[model samples]
Target chain A: MWSATDPRFGFWLPLALLCLATGFWLTDRKDSRKRLASVTLFASLALIVFFGANTRGGDTSETALLAVLLHMLGPVALMAIGSLIATFSGPTPVGPLPRGLRPLGFSMAIGGLIWIGLMLIEEPPDAIANGIGETIWGAWVEVFLSILILVATLAGAFCIMMGDERHKEAFTLTILTISAGLMFFEIMHNGSDGLEATGWYQIHWQQMVFLIGGLLGIILAFIAFIALVYMAERRAPDPDVVAPLTEEEKSVVDAVLRLNLELEEVEE
Target chain B: MSEKKDAWWGPIALLMLLIAFSMNLFVWQLSGGVEFSSIIDRMVTGFSLAFGITSFALLFVSLGAVHKHMRWQEQILGLFGCAYLGIKCYGWVGNGFDSISEDAVILLAGLTAMLAAVGLVFGLLLALVTGREHIPDLLLEMDSTDGDVAVELED
Candidate 1:
């Protein structure tokens, strides 16, 4: 009953195809299969752009496209970039990040948090169309920020507990955590013009339930997988017995050992 | 001892924060008149949905990746588990299928998958960068052989 022209179809089908294509492209062993995946990926992307631009200016489709782009670029991208920079530039830099980049990373992370605040307080993308509603977006932000805040708080606490001169790092984390917590509280009690307080609260409750459930699921799956591996290993048969080395084999081994010893002596 | 005493405050601070948040939630619930049963129902639904999806994905992926190395018994068990998980997921999601529009579900699933993929990529990159040196050692540990087994002959 659905047509390609339907906005929902236009948006969702291509997105699903894109995801499938990407997964296949990543995992496929054959070059031909990879080529097929690549073609699918490009086609799906083209379809999305075509459908998005097919509508006239100010239409729901166009608005939806713009909103989706904004959501991707605004908070999601910014947070990822910020976190990467912060991790590499922190006091205990994770990788080979330069110590000098610390300030820049710190600033970028703060900027990301500020952008999130602006999105929540001033300019929420509530006018999304094509069946993408505010509830989903709100629930996402709730879950994302809640996880960030909780993890940061716990990390900060642990850092402080180490008693190893990580106070400055802990302080920074605490500040970020508190700022995020404040933002969450603000949204919870005095919801912005885009969504009512009760609606936001409901979304938060549902998302919290989902998050907890997901965590539990991850733990259970991990345990189950480990058990399976353990059982399989236990049931594995012993190696087949083999004959001892022949004269030729022994000679070959002696030659290799003598060569290694000569090399070691020369090095010494 | 002084340092240890100082570290005690850190956990206490975390505990206080937890208590404060709990109290705030309790107050909100009291004011909001939200039913406890509804919360329980949602939690159960969430658990079933997440558990089923995660187990299925994990088992299916592992089976595919190591199919050649796995024994026939293991493969059969994994396939059976995957089927069971798939059925459970369908049952849970199907119960509320009508409530959620197909478009919304697709969109949510797509977004969640994208986010998870991105997170995984980032985590892997960080791990690669931080733990590059240990990788060769790990491989060697796996590949290293134990001493030769000795069989005694009956006289």
Candidate 2:
């Protein structure tokens, strides 16, 4: 019997929901920003639904149904989010994703789901060996954290340099495309580790996941680079036909010219 | 073009790799249950410290360019960044006012300010590195020139 008073279960159910909401909200939408920004507001709304269901239900079955639904929907939602980001990055009407990125995003989402399933199966509450399990899990966390921080810092550098909307969107898409799987793995791994703080999984699984994820990110970027090269070659603009500036730009340039006193204005 | 390419990437990539390696040490140090005394002793001569400082300096440089390009947004954010750092420094470096309520107010304000500083700086830094900031050349014929992407989009 899972007690309502038990801190572990009490803590987890809400946390899972929070992670879901955060994932949903953080997704860089092409049309609009995340509508629900306040955690308290979302938490209150979540509580209303949970309590509403709780009052009208077979408690155990209802809880189990939700758990299953959440786990199943998690990876799918991640894929959808990544695809949305991809649409923003890739050229519209022509292609929704840069050639290699579609497969890469799919792989990440599926790989994350697989890892989560394996981890859940391997980690049970009444585990016989806990120490060895913790050791491996801890190592997995340490390595993952190291890589995550390094990658984020470098990305921060790139984000600082690229101010244009299209380029910013490209970077955002690149991150989501490459990392949707790893981020899923992160969420799952932490959840399992927190559940009992004990999980005897093969350490190779962690290393293999990390390797596959890093390689996929690299491959996606490489493909995008090639796509850019091919795009330039295919759609070469005429050497003589320079684009005319818009009225706004002409005025801005004129303002600069006037400020510099390089060009005197003639009577209209 | 090749020389320019080499100059742009050579030092930056090497520095990033070095920073990445040092960050591993940072994670190791911050993580659970360790011999604190010996680790603190090694902290004096650790490569991680130097690497961390270098990264911070580079981050500042990146943010400074962002600040320059960011225009009015920079001034708005910088005022808040300075305030947060000021309050945090007061707490960290010295004992401030006697009232806990006042301290709490500063803490809350500090947190918000810190978020603004971090989020804005990181986003701006990346923007500046990737995008071209407008620099008008008065002597050049404006009709002939267009804004070029700083790191050419055409590979």
Candidate 3:
């Protein structure tokens, strides 16, 4: 039972509507699932954000089912989002999804609904963990996070390095290698701690790594900027150099054209 | 490199940003600020992450820029990916794996397996129901776009 007047709902309703509106505006007839996913996501966000993590509203027994479903909202919204990303990054949206993927998708979507059912069985108060199948299912977060880190660093490298020459990549690679080497200095390294370490709570090595990473990012931006400028400037050929062609060169060009046209006509 | 019809990812990311911002704004008045903030923040962080995820997904799967060939497979995979993250949320929260009872955990696994059978049943039913012609296209899409189709009839 959603309370339309739950003060918090006041804040969330409008925001959810905004998401719906934005999704509507951004999408068209073809990508209806995207719009549906977007709207569902926003609506789920409203439920999660406005109601807080406590899905029960006020009562414990009354909102139990709602709470369980609410728990599912975040997961569904996340799936919808992930779906959007998959759609975005994959082969240009086509007539149908790639062949092997459909089975996986069906299983996954059904799996999600199953997950929701499982969550409903004995809705745990905690946002995650403590559910019926906490171990296998719960570990999904860290798995994806680890994978995300790998993807980010690699894709970021490609996104920045694309269209550049081999030497440029070699240079960046060399710099990165050197950066890793510097970590051996111990002074340049931070005593490794998990994400639990606060910003100020971190040791000197962490700050060093942070500073170095930041510097490299800025440096990469500058390099990209320089490359763009050079590319723009180099778009035109040198003006002071060879004019059209010397008469002797012109004769060569005329002969080449004649031969090419003869070849074309013969081929035709 | 594959070219995109439009930078659709940009707007999607922007929308994620907006959602993230809105989440922050909503929790501006809270008691356990850190935990609540982190929960929403974790979800919002996916905005910047869209690039990496999309990049990775694109590496293996091929989805067109427009609504050209998007079908149930894509719909499920994306939906499944979302559903899959539910496990992740669980893994990260609380004492994580440490707090769980090993025996009880097995039950959870069985529960999922049993429920997966149920999911398959439901999926089959849905396929049958939505297979009807009167039903509109259910693929995630907007009302109108460049890809919209026009039909002609011959008398």
2 against 3, candidate with superior lDDT: 2
Per-residue CA lDDT of model 3 for A47-158, tens digit only, reads 6455544443333221332333455456454444333333333343344455455345534543443444344334345433333223233222222222222222333344
How well does candidate 2 score on lDDT at residue B30? 35
Which runs in model 3 stand beyond 4 Å of their true positions? A1-106, A109-240, A263-268, B1-18, B32-155
Worst 10 residues of 3 chain A by lDDT: A186-195
- Candidate 1, DockQ to 2 decimals? 0.12
Best-to-worst TM-score order: 1, 2, 3
Lowest-sum lDDT 10-residue window in model 3 chain B: B47-56
**Interface DockQ of each model:** 0.12, 0.02, 0.02
- Residue A239 C-alpha lDDT in model 3: 53
Assess the local accuracy of residue A37 in candidate 1 as a C-alpha lDDT between 0 and 100: 74
Q: How well is each residue in B38-117 modelled by candidate 1, as lDDT tens digits? A: 66665655555555555555544453344344564664476358547744664565474443332234224334534632
Q: What is the C-alpha RMSD of each candidate to the true structure, in Å?
A: 10.9, 25.7, 25.4
